[model samples]
Target chain A: MYFLAIGLIYLAVGGDPAGIVALLMASGLGGLIAGFAWHFGRRYGTRVEDLQDSDAPDATGVVGVYPTASLRPIALAFGTTLLVLGVPIGSWMSMIGAAIVASQVLLLVHDTDD
Target chain B: MTTIDRKPSAPTVTLGGDDPNHLVSIDSVIGPSGQEGTGLPTTLVGWLTTTNHKALGVAYFVASLTFLAIGGGLAGIIRAELTSPGQQVVSEQVYNQVFTIHGSVMVFLFAVPFGFGLANYIMPLQIGAPDLAFPRLNAFSFWLYVIGGAVMLFGFAADGGAAPFGWFAYPPLSGASGSPGLGADMWIVAIILTGTSGTLTAVNVIATITMLRTPGMTLFRMPILTWNLLVTAFMVLVVFPVLSGALLMLLADRQFGTKFYVPTDGGSPILWQHLFWFFGHPEVYIVALPFFGVVTEIFPVFARRPVFGYKGLIFATLTIGALSTSVWAHHMFVTGEVVVTFFALTSSLIAIPTGVKVFNWMGSMYGGAITFEAPMKFAIGFLVTFVVGGVTGVMLASPTLDFQLSDSFFVVAHFHYVMGGTVVIALFAGIYFWWPKVTGRMLSERLATWHFWLLMIGFNMTFFFMHLLGREGMPRRVPDYEPISNWELWNQLATAGYVILLISMVPFLIAVVKSLRGPANAGADPWNAYSLEWATTSPPVEHNFEWIPPIRSERPVFDFRWINHDDVGAPGVAEAWMAREGLDDRWLPLAGPVAADVADDANAASSADSDVG
Candidate 1:
């Protein structure tokens, strides 16, 4: 939505607005995809219970125990916000945000439990 | 899982003798003198087709040293040319070729092979494994490297002279109109072949580390050196394929008039930078990070303390590896095409993990009974020099500063500080540390000290002034400069430093000669080290270790001593800590056909794709 607004503003404000809008749109779209992927993975991937049995030390141990659904809305919101902000800066930021989203999804959904 | 007593107290057994540990079967033909020398079977068959990892390691060491000398000579030529500047030394064209080849040889052949020489010779023994996971691929990789190196050097004698393009070979410059010669083509072919060797070697090492550990040895239990190599192998796997692909595409452009990089032909020059840095950024780590591991491994041993924050150091290693890819675009900040904040943030972000490593090393050294042996001296030197290099690296990672320093002597100074100063220094440390094991003898500490001081003084003198040169706005890769450039005096100083560094090699050579000719004095553990490799005799037999024990920790053999003898507080606490992380013994799961199959499949796919195209 923020990306759409940026596009509309670019269209309405003038001076390479199309290029700006296109850049924003591309970046925005990338971020959205990434966020969704992360959300999905977080929802379905490895859970706290899965890691409980292993002795492997992980950074996410603290965050692991939280219920997936409980974390989802917040993650989605955060990712969306990052996606919106990342577009204006350039492709690299959007890609970073996208990676974050993707990794989140991997964390959420790449579970052995099926 | 199996115990065969080829203990230090017993007479040496042939590799393929009646001992159950012997599998390759070359022990029977070892002549009477073989007890004192390489227990190599007296047969052409054994030398050529034998899959002995120890033999392969010897080959790597020999090849690495030969390339080191060649690369050093190339460096001398480059420094000589830059001495006074102007055409007084060599032609501009010839200088271009010389430096290009020099950089290529030093980075690809010298520094890289130096690390691998240690890894190849030591990793399996340290892990309590008999051989690497894919021994044939190890041999194949070594051959391919030699073949590729030879081919690239052959380009020097090509009809148009060697490749005059910079080592990076950025496109448009390397394109048909820019190069118009086969020299560039030879470089492309050679490096692509080399990249393939790297990728294969990486895969083999990774597989070996992951799958072949002795029982009870987990990932966290691996030694710091092995852990570093593990991370480096993964880095190589991720980056080398991209380099291979990029070079292949470049080769296609040159040979078949494809316009992948020719701007007039709609090729993007920036694309080449992207591709090159994709490999190039990680390539720096590929060369330096192992030395970081080398020095890190040595510090604890000499300091007589456990490696501080072993787990944190492991995390830092992995983090550095992952973050390395994201920061490649920092190299492009001068071009202004890169996303500034994105790269800047990532570049600065790397400092966090690097800082962790520095802290860990310092912590390891703190309050410990430190002994500044020759190896210890080099290790300490690594800490100091690498910190300076790392700090400067963080500074350059900023786009704001990078814009001013790119293509300047500052860039050269920065890299040489890390690569030449830190990595090479650490490599010497590793050499000094392991020379007794590899050769069954000890290097002279007196000569080693001489070597160390000269290297330190000469290296700093050569590169320290370059900071000023860059500040004064001198450009790099130029063969000649006018008298008025103000870089003449600094250039002469830097050149003199190179000469000093060259002279420093003499003491090092003398030390090596003294070690080989001196005595067979290094017992199983002359340093009283803790790792599994030291549990075996100096210059380990073909199978390395005889009794394959279930590894309870990273320091398996060291653990045995502690458990059996109740010596938890060893003389060198760090060595004990390293030994405590030893792995259980397992045979490397090397099936030669697997690599052969993969190469075949890849070749088939490429040929099929070509046919379809």
Candidate 2:
């Protein structure tokens, strides 16, 4: 909302198209955050953080399940390095990087299913 | 000579219900025994794949420090070249590349990432969260940073020998006609990747601060460091994307014959400035705020008082973040195109919140028992130098003044005072303060004293003279200068100061090396601190805390310690109880003799209440 208002103001003040586009993009990001917050608030209801009379222990006991370990980050990083390097190097490197990235994404989804 | 055990003390209280799945008993969470089934492997592969925030935080520190060494080495070369006059060290082209790479490495790789590193390690502990909201994404961000930084350095090995167009890479200067090289292209690609990493990390930080704060640690109740990081993350999320976009456009202009910055071809070079500074200005606050948070945390701890006007500090931080977005055009004041008055106004407004913070830090120390530990010493150095920097910043904010001083050594001095003097000094303070909690060992105080004094003297000597040099019309980013007036003298002094600065790091490195090789003498609550991090072991367990004390105040650990031991009427009794409980004597009021006074005041208050009844 802040970005939206700023964008509108910039547009009113004869700002450049690029500047306006940047402002609008920021507004879109703001909207995404708002949406995320709305979804989370609805799903989780009132958290202990929101309560006035809550103790520290009230919010304890496994906040959420997190991964113990995974090789995907390093693998994905290797793929990204290649993908970015391909821009300066060649198209073949990009192809190989894209394949690895695709595989990592599939594996991530498959792991989530388990 | 007492070796502080890293093992957690047994749980003394229990809470929540008896349901096995939902059990929140203190015993359930507090010890290595409880973590038997959930231990992360202690192997190289484990480190590569680990999504633990603490481990990733350590990685950030190591990578950032490595980059700092590289950047500092580049700075040494630049200073060495400029020490005398005409191109004494490197060619003009090599000089440009050297300074550009130095600026890029320092800002992007070292300063920003160091803050994130501190935040990653400490913020979760401060907020009582086990890890960041997105643990996997956190690891991914770290790896991306590593790759991006590696690629950035790899630019020097490229065909054209790195980007010579400066860190900002403004306009036609950065175009194919200006810097037609694979190095520039690599620089762009590296920045885009790192910017993406920063954006993703910002999202992770924001989500963690917002959602993962433990019960009673409300947004306002959070420690100032976490609050600063939360605001810093928001700024990062908004601005880093702009930088990434700008870099992408620059790449397009360079490679694809785009006219984005080609003014003759219906494009404006000023557009790039608009986008860059929009990110760049906030980027200043993004780096500085976390360090400011570090000092804010330090002042209260060393002064042995709660942060004065804590809520006001929060509002001040928020105000700074909000105003920072509007003040980006102040960097372009000399361009003669921006609304100089409005930009100037927004930029000046930042000083108010910053002043509030400075005063609040003073207020925190006023009329309080204070200690002169290395962290506090460095923090005091930060206060003095940062004020000087802040005043200069306000002076620079004025369009009339900026028109004269823009691109001069004055600008260099002002930012270095803030970034190098303030941020880096505060970073040292934080490192000294938290070394125990991070490593489960104590850094040498004797060495810390030498490090602090050398840094303070060296930093001031280096940058303070640049103000006069700049005022005398010496422009920055120059490889060599004419010996007109006192330019040569000031340059020589600055170079000399840089040597002192270089020497200062020696003691700090030794301290770190010695501490790591030494025993774990810094027991939990080494400084008898206020925050949650100190409530746990020196180096916390795999899951951070075994048991979090009830968060009745921002100073949860302080409240827990004093309140639990309130039954002891005197210092002797307190000592007896500590000894009976096998507590290290070092934990007994390392802040000062003030703890005994506080205990007396508490006893008096309780007895007076009984008399009234």
Candidate 3:
């Protein structure tokens, strides 16, 4: 629909009929492919049912530990540090001090319980 | 006496349900038969509210392909103009803008996202995790991409129109006084937003890969795709911000009275170049490495052999990431601000690692039962084209050669070979390889074959002659050329190639539509694959799995086939371990503040341990 709309718009604007035809063909074809890809993807792609039951365990008393949920914040903090370099809160010393404080805060949380 | 090193204490263990120490089993989570699977969600909720790494991967792939088609259409416009190159088509300025947006859209919006999408969807699943550490942030990052990309394009619909300053949006030319339009500003803001998305997503993926692996899924044991993604994520964190910073400054310069680039106001335009390339060079690898990973994934699968020199491949991947950062000045060899020798040396050295990878890929195929599946064909196509591109890159890397070739179509030709020829081919290969996994149905092999041939032929026809044209002193970014130049023949041939390429894409479309309506079914493990992903059904349900199955090797499905053949029933002893091993219910785990918190937690945990000892 988007392609056809664009093609019609092109024609309305006095674009070459042949060019408009070519473009519509390209877009219509691309959209068809994408739609089918999604359809088949939905049908044949991995589904939840194939996996083992979520609540049951084959083994006894085995605990798994993933990273505690604080990793993104540290990364954001680091990003913030870089962003702050663009500003002049202080001289180079201010930048250094801020970096130290951010690093220390990151270090103080989320120890590897896993 | 040296203190004897000891491993850290393992987590607590319990039998069957919610055991913290045991992270592998199928019976505990995601109950059987109509119960919600342990993955993410399978229904609309799974797609809308869920956060599985695999689902995200599929989303990225779909998004990237849409942009690819859009960018390809833009390319068609560019080719049409250059067909005869005499103002027979659009005006010179429109032509310039078309090609510029064409390159920028393809490289930044299309190609860079291509690898990231694949990596996001597949990396965690391949490594036996259920979801990314930062699920919400992942969604946020993707949203940012959509918003940024749209804003950039929307600039076209604006009063001044889309940016025509090329992908780099080089300053002076890009400035308000010079261009005096919102198109460039749109490009600036859009890219800044996009760069932010890239940076955040990189941090998320890196943290997920580093901290969220299942039991025994160590770094070395990870799939090549995951490893490449890891490197890519790291590079994204390092490089994208530089681009973001540059874009912000550029925006300020253009919008406000900021003098970041205005020389009379104590700003140097060359500084903009430095900042841009600082991100630009690595941005190339950022686009390429994931394809390298995809190539790595496809080669062994079709060849029916394990990857050769796995460690070497990993090292080469890492080397490319690190070395890529130092070689940014290679693009600026003619600018004279760069230390020519330093950049030249760094640039030449990058070839060694790239060569190592080529050798390893070939080595992997040696003595193996190689089959020319469509995916493998594309992968092999990448190997051939990328090598040529690499050669050109090496040539351009040289200070003298680059001085000669800089700003010429030669550089354009080289990059198209590398970025367009290689990465785009690999992307097609990845689509073919994972299509069944994503769609639960197979694409028409006949149509796939047609698509491959046309893609290969048309691409070469369009790009190969550009090298010659560029060598003949035709520079890029020009709309019309004098009739006396010999560039006409090559340009004509290239335009014809674009037409052919457009034709080639048609069959794939037909195949997609035909297959979707047909009765083809892709059962789980259609290719007899090795990997946890194959264990699930084709087109996995909402919430990936009904039960979290046990994983021994990286190829859990295959291992399941070889080992105990019994069906691990729902609520079996394995469920607890699987839940522990797999992802949480929600997808975005660490995008918020997980990265910062994890380090601190680790530090606190370590100090407590030391104090105890």
Candidate 4:
């Protein structure tokens, strides 16, 4: 919402298109957050957080299912490093990076299903 | 309030019990731990793939400290060269690379990540959350940072050395025609990766804080540090991507024949400033606020008082974050294209909130039982030096003054005062305060005292003279300077201060090594601090806390201890207080032996008091 306001103000002031784009990008991020909040608020309505008089222990217990460990993040990082490095180096390197990224992403999705 | 006077029926949970070492695993209480799996084995591979926030935080600390050493070495070279005027230490080209890499490495690799690292380790603990909302994403962000930083440093060994156009990398200097080297491209790639890493981390922080806070840990009940971090993450989310975008445009101009910053080819060089400073100005607060949070946390613990005007501090932080975005044009005033008055107004307005924070810290410490531990010492150093920096910052906000001091050592002096003087100094305070908590060993007080005094003297001596040098029209970013009246003396003094500053790290290093070599004697709650982090053991176990006390206020741990009358050695007092406060029914079956011992102690204490009367 703040980002949206800033973007509108910049537009009103006849700011640069590039500057406006940046502000709009920020607004998009803000919207994403708002959307997430709305979705979660509806899904898990009136949590202890919403109740002012709630006790701390009421919020305790398993918060969420957190990943204990995963190797896909490392693979993803490696692929990204290679992909970015290829930008300055060569197209062949980029091709290999893209291949690794595609394979690892597939494996990640499969892992989630299992 | 919903009347809880009627004892609500619920299963009782005992806190610390008779066994003394009875660890209360939340997993045990809340059913299956959900930890059993054929996931990555607990080995080197497990560490590599670790999504644990604490482990990743340690990695951040180690990596950032290494970069700090590298950056400090480059600074040593720059100071040594400028010690006697003419370029006696290295060639002008080397000098340029030195300062450029120094600035880039310090700002990008060291300062920003250091804050994130602290946040990673401590923020979750403070908020009573078990872990960040997206642990896998957090691990990915850490790896990205590590890889990105390594790639950036790899530029030093490139054919044409590293990018020498300064940290901001303003074009046409950073353009293909100007740099024409792979080093510049590598720097851009590295920044893009790190910027992405920062943005993702910001998302994770925001998500964790918003969604994962322990029940009863309402937003307002949160510690000041958490509030500051929330604001900092918001700023990072907004600005870092903008920086990434600008960098990408610069890369395109170099590689894809785009003219985003090519002034000769229908591009505006000033556009780069607008884009960069738009991110750059808030980037200052991005680094500073965490440390500001650090000192705010420290002041209260040592002074033994709640933060003065806690809500006011939060409001001030929000105000500063909002105003920082608008004041970026102040940096571009000399370009003769900006609305100087508007920027000047916004820039000066920022000082009011910052001033409110200073008063809050002072008010926190005004009449409390203040202790000048190593943390307090460095925090005091932060207070005195940050005021100087703040005053100079306000002075520079004026367009007329900024025009005069533009590109001068005064500008250099001003930022260093804020960044190095406040941020770095407060970082030391945090290191000292939290070292025991992190390492489970106490740093030697004697060594810490030496470290504090040496650094304080050296830092002030070094940057203070630069202000005078700037006033006398000594330009910054130059390899050599003509030996004018007192210019030589100022340079000599500054260099001498640098040497002292360099030497001061010795004791700190020694203290770290010595403490680590010793036993883990620093118990949990070493200073009896108020925050939730101190509630757990020093170097908390895998799941953090065994049991968190009821958080009725921001200082839950303090309240717990107060109810127990732990200072009076009265154990049963906690039960009595809980019963009186109508909390007994909620958490009964109070540790039997411990309760008995407490009851005995309370009786003994009462009798002793009566006898004295």
Give the top-scoring candidate (DockQ). Answer: 2
The ten-residue window of minimal lDDT in model 1 chain B covers B582-591
lDDT of 1 at A85: 30
Model 2 spans > 4 angstroms off: A1-17, A59-64, A112-114, B1-42, B564-613
- Superposed by TM-score, candidate 2 places the C-alpha of residue B419 at a distance from the truth, in angstroms, of 0.6
Q: Cα miss at B519, model 3 (Å)?
A: 4.3
The superposed Cα distance between candidate 2 and the true structure at residue A106, in angstroms, equals 1.9
| Per-candidate interface DockQ score | 0.02, 0.35, 0.02, 0.34
Report lDDT (CA) for all predictions. Answer: 0.67, 0.80, 0.67, 0.80
Q: What TM-score does chain B of candidate 2 reach?
A: 0.88
- Candidates ranked by lDDT: 2, 4, 1, 3
Tens digits of per-residue lDDT, candidate 3, B38-153, equal: 34345764455334556566667777788888889888877777777577767776776677778777877888877778767677667545467666577656656765677667
Off by over 4 Å in 3: A1-114, B1-55, B546-613
- Over A1-114, each residue of candidate 2 has an lDDT whose tens digit, in order, gives 767776777677666576677778877876787788899889999877766445543332233456767888878877887887787678899899898888887786676522
Write model 4 residue lDDT over B427-517, tens digit each, in one string. Answer: 9999999888787799999999999999999998899999999999999999899999799999999999999999999999999999999
Model 1 bad stretches (over 4 Å): A1-114, B1-50, B484-486, B548-550, B564-613
